[model samples]
Target: MDPTNGDEKKKRFQEAFERGRDGHVGSYNVWLENHGFDPSRVDRDKVTEFFRENPTKSVNQDDVTDIAEYAGFVTTRQDLHHIPVIGPSGIGKTQLLHTVIGLLSEVDDDIDTKLLEANRLGKKTEDGFLLDEYSRQIAELTTPIVCIDDCGLDKRIRTSLRELRDAVDAGLFVTTWTPERWGVNQDQVRDVFSPAKEVHLRSFTQSETKGTLRVIYDYISQDNFALPSKTEERIHELSDGIPRLIHLLALESLREAYHKELVPGHISATDAAADRLNLSNASARVQDLSEARLTVLKQILQLPDERGVQPGTLVDELHRDKSTISYHLRELNEIGFVERDRKGRRAFYRVTETIEPLVQRRISQEAEYNA
Candidate 1:
């Protein structure tokens, strides 16, 4: 959530309440759809009453205060250069960036800051030649405080952001997503956005602030439930303060609490939320593995036991060539999907815990399709 003053925070929350009252297709709506729950089935009146009573917290003072102080206010413009907030996927980099935007807006009310969301950066647009027209428009901006979220989404998007990349006053407050576990080339991204104040989001101890907790509960309370402090702490532990995971797991936990349940961790509610989606998606992207790798993984996943299965066995059972199976097997192992154990002469491969849920989901989808 973006931060504001006390009154503004309340106003902002109220606005969200009104906006989501009609069941706007935001995260909550998406979450319901993803979990195969009917959004239309939920009691809107009950949810609305719960939100009005609870009054979800919207102010995150720490986010702005820490970032602004780090940016060095009242000091020289040099002290307040463009800051890049880098972190793993789902670690709330974009949320922090939005908070930074809110904080920076206080400096000048009349002037508007620019924001380029890399995810939404499509090539064509309704406004004519997309890059040419956009580049022209941004180049003319008086206040070039361009805030770009995840410029790494596409290297080509950086080509359109020359003004920010090359300027000081009119520069980028960029949030670069750098999850190395997902096989992202960190150095390549860093070099592209070089000569900026790089703040790698390594420490995630307090990512789930009180404001975040209240914000999440606003959605949960829609189910007519209260978030216990014990359950909250358990969620933080499981999510490791990642916002997406926190939101999903908290809602999943809230669902559990309805049936007199304890806190649901990643493993417990992984089927509920695709927490490892990034890991699986990244493996596919980085390797350009196509469906062949997934085919091999599905086969490996079907195999029984932690004792593991041999490549020769997979070759015989899958009716695929040994070399084809071996190629994907090696790549899958590199992506942490499968673990290989060599018992002196022969090697045995078994599916790792990280990708078990994804494989299971795929298997289920296949079963449903076949039926």
Candidate 2:
């Protein structure tokens, strides 16, 4: 094929890709509405009401409100502004961003909101063109809020965020992210975008947890199950003030109570036990423990002379499948629970000191049980 022909084909492919992405956003909006979430636009009053109703769970409500106000103010004064919402995982960062976009839509119906997952966008073959495409989309919108959820997860897209910063500085962009692992200092963060406010959303407070319980109770009220105050307190304690965890615990508790026909009144001891069992099951599923990784760590622990297992020996002992072991090791390393030491060409991994005791306890428990 001729070079010009190839170039034309590539351009067409890029257009198709962007069109598909826009369609996805539209479909997601429809889905949200179908699921009873108001996706049309978030109005200030509606957002305020939501915050008021869901009071205690406002991890960073004040900061979020301030950012939204600033974004609204900037657009009123000028043409555009960029606001980045930053926080750790499960800190309600994504929900807050969506709420802001909803608010923006209320202020201006012409305002268009596009939700993009950075990891998904990063997988595109024509990712290099995304920033330009995003800028064009923003330019065409009467009001635009481009929400890039999980922005810092993809290094390529994050580097490209500088281009977005340029657009924002030029009055054409807005974005958000949960920046738990960005590892950037304040100066670096500030340099990325003008009028960029980094709002740190911490975990829920104890009060917030109790409020979250109230919300959960309201949600499950249709089932005619009313949890006792003591049960609620126990659920809150187990949830550690994490909204998602609280929801999970509450749902599990309700399910258990219903299973035992203990709904609409004081929960029985059996119902509480069932709830505890459900919680344990849910936690185990989410923990993603790697047996092979655990085994390797166990062997290292068992060896009296060696402080750590030889990389090759460890691989041989685990012995299931090379790819599976490699994948588990990569995951463990990424999560900071494990680390590798390189001595020239050879690499050896050891359980991080913090995790060593936990691994030892698990192994010892298994050994005792087996014996």
Candidate 3:
């Protein structure tokens, strides 16, 4: 071959580098946009101002560290696939995953990524087309990193989730679900996502809750606003270490203040608590609660908090088949109307504290109407 012209050769190399780098960054930006981050909407000035005015408070270090570790593996295109991040609902599973994916996209534009929510998976009647579409889309992407949030929430999608095995083998999967869906043991968890690494997310500590509230207040407030100590403490108490509840409480409290036309000041903890209870009642009402299930819920609520009702007691009281009682209890637990606890080897189920007040209120109203 003839010797290359120096200027032309340098120009060709530069062009190739630019194309590669551009392709990488372009892919990442697309991922971020698809996941709802659309960087163009980001207000860099506001972010910079917030950082300057309020020093960053450390919270969710474990969550950040774990997600970053897995994200690093995914970005590097490693074989460490099937990451199941387990936590209760509203414990920041989706938020943590989004942040990790956002950071990964920023750093590696070439990586393929997709997010699927379990509840969004259509009903069994509609799953055929959905799965076909999922297969088609996944086929087009190369080594797609798929994060399926709330994996165990719906029964309709369990079969579809099983179909993800192919993707798990060929690419990577990061899923989040509650521990109640499956036990914490590796074998038990493997039923949901086999041969997987588990990242157990802890609920927010009281300090983390305060830090998070402050962070939220800073982000939404236009001025130097301070959350009252009592308001913060009440939020911490009623929120029960769940970040989603914390967010809901904060927003509802603000709305309460707004409705009262009060100057932007302290968010009333009482108002937040009432809104949360109302929300719980509304949610409980909307769910398809069969008479059997409702009766089961009522009984669970009557049981003392420390001593949750057992399946045998439910069977005795309802005169229902053991399997039927178990099914109803499982449904209630899944909807969060009930919580399951373990003492020794036996599992006990009880109505969740959040729903207790609503249940009691309904009972009182019914009694009054009867009288």
Candidate 4:
């Protein structure tokens, strides 16, 4: 249909919606009802006011701007582009993407934004009509932005990075995934997207952690919660620059302060919360070894015979620089994932039993599935 006819239909729908006087009657309304939210109790005006008050919605504007620029550069679209932001969970990836889309939509009335979780797409096992229709709508719409949340969580659909590369080639398709699982097939990923730009996001710095904590406290308390310089330093040290950990520590400290009716100044708290947060975040970083380290692990696990090759012999077989191999070996040894045996003056390395299965599985997956 022509633009005029489409506009007329939208106008008619609005008129009918207003005249009903009963309430909004549509799929969105139905969704609210199913989720146990009473449509009548939801005041549209209040929702608008809430969103206006929390414009950034827990996301930093600088990160959003960076992603927008990167997306534009890759998509070659002057106005908009789909960029995939990869990071660990609880690092505010989704928040950043949503903030950017909201900002872009505000500037251009013609742009439409749609958010879909990868697991909910028609790519799942128990498929539904809702997902099918949603995908169809996405393909049909001329929207400038489409954000797919948790793209790597759907193990079935994210089998290869090509699935996402194809989407990028077709149009803007922004997605987010954890570093460990961004692309399904790791070896084939580089082959599919030659020189694809990788934007690595590190945990916050000490200053950034302190700043984030201050912001959270200010937002929640509506008052400046003053702390001694040493207290802030301790918090930063304990949180280790992870944003989620910083937020948790700040909130926990605040809660303790509130419970005790402690004054805003000189608040003393235990570091237990920070320790727990660090333990939780550490697992996300476990699989993030460097390529050189992974190559060494693969070689040790893939050797045909039980008699593992010596470090020098393995270096010669792989035709890698001696220093590079040594660097990887040292890293693996430090991590306690590999052990070295001394044969005279020569060092022979073998995989520790704990990580041996993991290395073997990774190698087999890369050879069988990635190939």
Candidate 5:
């Protein structure tokens, strides 16, 4: 995005916040009561976080450890009063807080716990529903264990919410949302969460991405469904260890490959899951390949499957330099236009099954255009 566009957007949010802060947005004055926001220090993203939708997926491996630790912290030290869990969006912060609520109940069966997303609490703000009712619910909690998901989204009422948590002596578990992978969760954490032992979550690691996919794979295995062999590596590469991207790409790829439609009422299954988005991009990109690389791909498409062609074979068949052949082969494999098979220290290449027809179509078009 253009820097000026972002600056303008930020300016709008700051102006809106000022209206709320100065009591000009009279009905919404509850947000500034004890929320501790300084007009001089307003964070555009944190203060106006309702712009994003939370991405929820299966529990990742790191999240399991986080859940255990957080549940442990709350159960053993009830004196801390409030523990804010903060991280960039799609890092599973909301999922972690929700799990912690469940774990807290298991840790002590008698413990009462409730999970309320921040949006639900302040959803009626535009309808003139004073959030004081939600505040009252929090204030009178018989079960002092509370989980507030994505607290950044409704920060307008943060001061009132904090007071409610304190009034009930609640063991508040919260996650404040921030963006992901844009300069590494770039946001002003302090602008939203005060540093009272706030837990900062990290992005997913490659291993964690693979582990999360494996959990999904276990379910597909019973139906004999399988994905491409290198999917795990490719997904990890594409996601760069961001949990939301990892799951989105993996599930979409798997569903497209399996030719499956979502069952009724399963809202999370994307309607476009069967779209060959990556493959379509690869086709367009393949058309733009250098003459040398296109020749290499043409040969790979001709190579027989299972026993594919080696780089040395391409070098001899196409009369290309060995290093040039190797470079193009690596590029094709990375682009998902071709697959590499490893056998006892030897590597062979062929057009990927799903991409073979697309590659052939591009090659045919090139031949016709040249003719």
Candidate 6:
């Protein structure tokens, strides 16, 4: 039985207290061990501190410190409020929000929650239908918290953000957005989430990136396959602090090594270079794109490493609509010139390293001609 509910929790705590007070150290130690505590660890206040500090049984201290802190505040705060975790794509924004919700559930089993997806909110018609279904979903929810994962991604959701402000005022809405999109659409953010708390997550640091690489290394090395000396450094440089790219490149490298039938011992730098070369060749396919697609790639190339533009930004930059921008981005993705990452609803499209130099050379030539 779950001891958190009904009389079971009270009985357990009371027994622990009684055992501690009666000088029954042996019994108390057993109780502590049973509860996943160590009696050897000394504390002045005993089990009370343990119960207080560990309100949520699971706490992940590393790899997501910023995420954990924000989640902690949202779950423990007395007043229900809106929280929008803003960051770049592939940084685990959605996963962090869900983790918080799971931890909160441990304390309040009755905490009501629901997840609302923007794109699937309703179907479109020629005359443009109203978001009646969306209104009804928020209105009828018995849950105290309603999570809107991808806030600015869909046109319908972006347009309806103003309407959801009331839900935020009521402290029931949680949303996410990519920093680039959020910056481009500041007006929507200001109007819809005036009082919302925003948490911005940056890219991973070198140590963290190395740690991730170690995990990959350990996995491939289990088969006695050795990696190059500077393999981790090489991958970290190529990935540019983006976690998804790190995993993607690492997997590709492993696959290439296996395909070459290289002797099991040390994976060569040549094998690693082969993986990068393949990426470059795949990106070279962008030359087959039309002028229209090339225009989109040009703008994407100007974006910083591990940074991308949202559909709205692309629309504004290219003077196109959402559908057009999305279409071109998809094409760019298919050709490996641009890679897509999601923060919430916003999909950020950044040019891959394979095509970066080509785009930059074009830009330089254009600059010289204009000058």
Question: Which candidate number maximizes TM-score?
Answer: 3
- Stretches of candidate 6 above 4 Å error? 1-80, 122-135, 140-143, 167-169, 214-229, 263-371
Candidate 3: misplaced stretches above 4 Å? 1-61, 74-80, 122-127, 156-158, 184-192, 258-371
- Tens-digit per-residue lDDT, 32-51, candidate 1: 54544445544434433333
Candidate 5 Cα misplacement greater than 4 A, ranges: 1-78, 125-130, 179-193, 224-229, 255-371
Indicate the TM-score of model 5.
0.47
Model 6: per-residue Cα lDDT at residue 36: 39
Ranking by lDDT: 3, 4, 6, 2, 5, 1
Candidate 6 residue lDDT tens string, 1-371: 98568799888889978876754467544543443334444232332233234433212234234434444555566444556766555554555556556655775677666666654554565544435555555656443566677565555455566565444324346676655445445566666556355665545566667665554444334232334547666665655555555555654553344445443222463346435644433324544557788778766643433457777887887899889888888877776677888998767878765454444344434444775
Worst 10 residues of 5 by lDDT: 46-55
Q: Residue-pair clashes per candidate, as listed?
A: 1, 3, 1, 0, 2, 3
lDDT of 2 by residue, 133-222 (tens): 765565565445667776555455545567654454334344444332233322454565554555555556776676666654544343
lDDT of 5 at 177: 43
lDDT of 3 by residue, 174-257 (tens): 777654443323354466557456777766788888888777666655453667878787777666656666666765565445
Winner on TM-score (2 vs 6): 2
**C-alpha lDDT of residue 229 in model 6:** 41
Cα TM-score of candidate 4? 0.53
> What TM-score do all the candidates reach, one by one?
0.51, 0.53, 0.56, 0.53, 0.47, 0.52
User: Can you give the lDDT of residue 109 in candidate 4?
Assistant: 59
Candidate 5 lDDT, tens digit per residue, 21-90? 6434532222322232222212223211211222123444354455455545655676434456645455
Worst 10 residues of 1 by lDDT: 177-186
Worst 10 residues of 6 by lDDT: 42-51
Give the distance in Å from residue 277's predicted Cα in candidate 2 to where it truly belongs. 8.5
**Per-candidate RMSD, Å:** 15.9, 15.2, 18.8, 18.0, 22.6, 17.5
Clashes (candidate 3)? 1
As for candidate 6, its clashing pairs are: 150-344, 150-345, 226-267
Cα lDDT listed for each candidate: 0.53, 0.53, 0.61, 0.55, 0.53, 0.55
